[model samples]
Structure formats: structure tokens, C-alpha cells
Target chain A: MNQGWTERQRPPRLERRLEFADYETTRDFLDRAALVSERLGIYPDMSFGRTYVNITLHAQDDATEVGEPSRHFAREIDILLETEKTLDE
Target chain B: MNQGWTERQRPPRLERRLEFADYETTRDFLDRAALVSERLGIYPDMSFGRTYVNITLHAQDDATEVGEPSRHFAREIDILLETEKTLDE
Candidate 1:
């Protein structure tokens, strides 16, 4: 994460951000995220501003206790971003 | 979509829903969708209710006009759902 931008070159804002609370949760997570972006006037596959950025999310959670009470745990989010202009438009 | 359940077996409610405005936009779409789920107390990777359902989204937008003004168009949404009890709990 935050590997591309140099310390001085990175902007204060994130082009796109994806966070999740568990693993293999991308399917459900993405659904809700897209809904939010649409409400915010940002529709996926639709260009926004002058730049095209893609962000991804991957999440995982695990809590296993045989005899004791089960404790929930999750940490799985994968984000991928790309900069490009719309080819069709 | 909705191919698994027989007509009689299908429920009136959707286990999960994923809708998008374009194609190959999973990265950004998923990010925003997940955010919305979290706010809805349905954080990704976290079990909810008695069933585990996974929903996916795939969107595509295309507008090609050589001499005319471009008109935005998009229609890409894939949804998947699964019913299973939690193993850990």
C-alpha cells in the first residue's frame, strides 16, 4: 500500500481507497461500495473528472475456538488502482 | 444470475445485490460498495444473520461518437448469493 507515490509527490487525497473487515469478502464488499460511489456522483466504468482511477478491495475474517467462546477476527482488503483515459469516450 | 434457486425456492428478498454503471470497473466499484455495506452494519468478511451470501458486481460503460457529442452509457452488474451456516460459531 502507498508504494507508488514518492513521499513528496503523493497528494493529500486518495484517488481511490478500499478497505474490508475480512477475507474473500470482495464479492459483498464491492456491491456496497459501488452503491456509495453512485450516490456520490461517481459511477464505476464511468469517467470522473479528467482521470480514471480504479480501486479494489479484498477482505477476510477468521474466529475459531473449539471449547471457548468464539472470537471474530478479520483482515482482508486488496486495492488496485490504474490511471487512464476512457477509450470509448 | 439467479440461476441457482428454483422458482419456488427463491425468496422474495435478495440475499445480496450488486449493481454497476459500467464494465471492468471492479476495483473502484468494489471499494465504494464495501464502504456502504460497512455503514449498513454489514461489514465484509463479518458474518451476519444465519446465512452467508456473497454478491459480486461487474459494470461496463461505452460511448463512441466520432463527429457527434459523446453520450455516456453503462450497464454491468453481476450478483451472486450463497446460503451456508458459519463453521466457527
Candidate 2:
């Protein structure tokens, strides 16, 4: 147990790594995500100049064998990012 | 860097620790959260029950001296839990 992780970091810089099914799904997910954040009163402060949303994915890794769920998530997040960009523009 | 974390854990057991402003807000957030998950094609499998939603709060911790944001989040999650219970009934 890294004591440094707990004591030094009171609440610590919390982050989320949500998985999804595919790109289209991720895009749909982001729409709902923004709504959820808004409802929670924790609006996304992209200008906060901090690592607010650090979303990563793991699609079918034909090279090293991945899980169905993992691949699905990676594809989903990727789609979410793409959709976010389009929505922004 | 704990090599065990990378090699042993392929995709790794991902978790999310979302923070909110207050209890009511968290409840609202949960409603949105469910919608978002469904949109993402990552519907909540509460039945699987393997540390899916591990929400914690740090509302006004007079004992250790916490921050407003942290306290706000804790209070929010507590409310969310309460609301979830009520919704179930």
C-alpha cells in the first residue's frame, strides 16, 4: 500500500476510466455524460488546465489478445472523443 | 512503477470516483449516469456486483480539514445513495 498515495493525496486527483462498446456508442455516451455532469452540478471545466477527463480505450488488440468488453470500451471512448469534437464545432 | 499492475492486469480493473456538488445534485447525476451508461452500451450490471460503484464522500471533515469541493462531493454521493435506495423501493 503506497502511503504516499493516501496521506499526501487527501482526496487525491481523482480520475475516471469508463469503458464502452464502440465508437457510435461512445459518442452517444458522451452526450449523456455531459448531461449527467451538468445535473450533478459538476460541470466540465475543460479550461481548468488540469487532467479533468482522461478517457482511454482498449479495442481488439489482435497483437496481444484482448477481452470482448475491453475492446468494446476502447471503441466506445474513441467514438465519444470524435463526437465531442464534432459537437464542439 | 509496479510492474505487477501492467503485466498481471491486462486492461486492469477500472474504477470511477466521480465527485459532485451536493446530495441532491448526486441524485440528479445518478439519473443522468444511468442514461449515459445505457447510451454508451455499457449498461450497469449491478447484479454482477464486483465493486461497480464505489462512491465515497468527504463532506466537511472537521477531523482532518478538508476542502469545500471535496466535502461537496461526499455529501452529493451520500444523497445519491439515498435516492438510489428510494428509487429501488
Candidate 3:
């Protein structure tokens, strides 16, 4: 499992929750994450509130493991968040 | 509650699950939905798989109602799905 993600046993998914300072930043991150998902052709289950975003990536096909694509997507998400933070600063 | 959506009791939110024919279509709909959320300034908690997308919209503040924005967003989502179906035909 990745640092921020918790592995779910029943359905076999990797889940992560990220918190931001405020609503607009959280929403902006979601928008950017959506664009990244589109570009990468891999989408995560996502939920958000005023200050947090939750993402879950399910293991495909009976693999029982969070595949490379999911890992890559998660890493890319980290990068996106970092970039956004840099831009905000 | 809306036709395709269910009201969740504990957290007081509106939830819906939509099924598509294939993975590509599911992802495409997600991309479109993200754009709609951005445009509307309201985001849903979203999750998806090869053929299904699940969404939840939480009621803000202490209000137990789904609120105007969530309802409007849901209606717009229906319109988006209908428009996509027509284009696919």
C-alpha cells in the first residue's frame, strides 16, 4: 500500500483521503485530478467535501493487487497536488 | 429524492449509480461530469468501474435538504447523459 492510501480488503481497492486548507483549493485539485485521469485514461472513484477529497482505485480483473496503472495514477496525483501547491505559493 | 438517485440517511446526502455499456463510455461520462461540476461550482463524490459510475452529493451546513445546487446539478447530469446517448446513436 502507498503512504497515504489504505488498502480495502473486501472489494480490493486502494483508498486515500487528502485534506486541503479550504473549499476552493480542494475543488481545484479535483478538477486537475479529473483532467489527469482523462489524459491517463484511468479514473479513480472520487469524493470531496469543502476541505477534503477521497479517492479509491479498484484492482482490475481478479488481480487482487492494485495494478501498475493505479500506482502510476496515484503517483501522478501526488505530483499534481505538489504542482498546485507550488503554484499557489 | 430524484428518480435515479437515492437519499442516504446518516450523512444526509443524495446518491446515484449509473451504468454504461463499457469502460470507455464510463470514463468519457466521468470526464464530462467533471467538466459539468467545474462549470456548476458543485462537485459530487464520484467513483467508477468498468461499467458503472457512483455519485454522492452531500447537503451543506446543517440543512437536511439536498439543496438547489445539488438538484440542479443532478438535472444537468441527466441532460448530459441524454445528450451523450443521442450523439452516440
Best by DockQ: 3
Taking the tens digit of each residue's C-alpha lDDT, what string does model 3 give over B1-89?
34898888777898889999976687688778867887888877776655788888889879888899998899889899889989999
Best by lDDT: 3
Better of 1 and 2 by TM-score: 2
**A1-89 in candidate 1: lDDT tens per residue?**
34432111122221233433343334444444444444443332221111222342212123122111110101111231221112212
Model 3 TM: 0.68
Regions of model 1 farther than 4 Å from truth: A1-24, A44-89, B1-89
- Alpha carbon lDDT at B30, candidate 3: 72
The lowest-lDDT stretch of 10 consecutive residues in candidate 1 chain B is B67-76
On TM-score, the leading prediction is 3
Query: Positional deviation of B15 in candidate 1, in angstroms?
Result: 32
Give a tens-digit lDDT track for model 3, residues A1-89: 34897888778888999999976687678668867787888877776655788888989879888899998899899888778878888
Worst 10 residues of 3 chain B by lDDT: B42-51
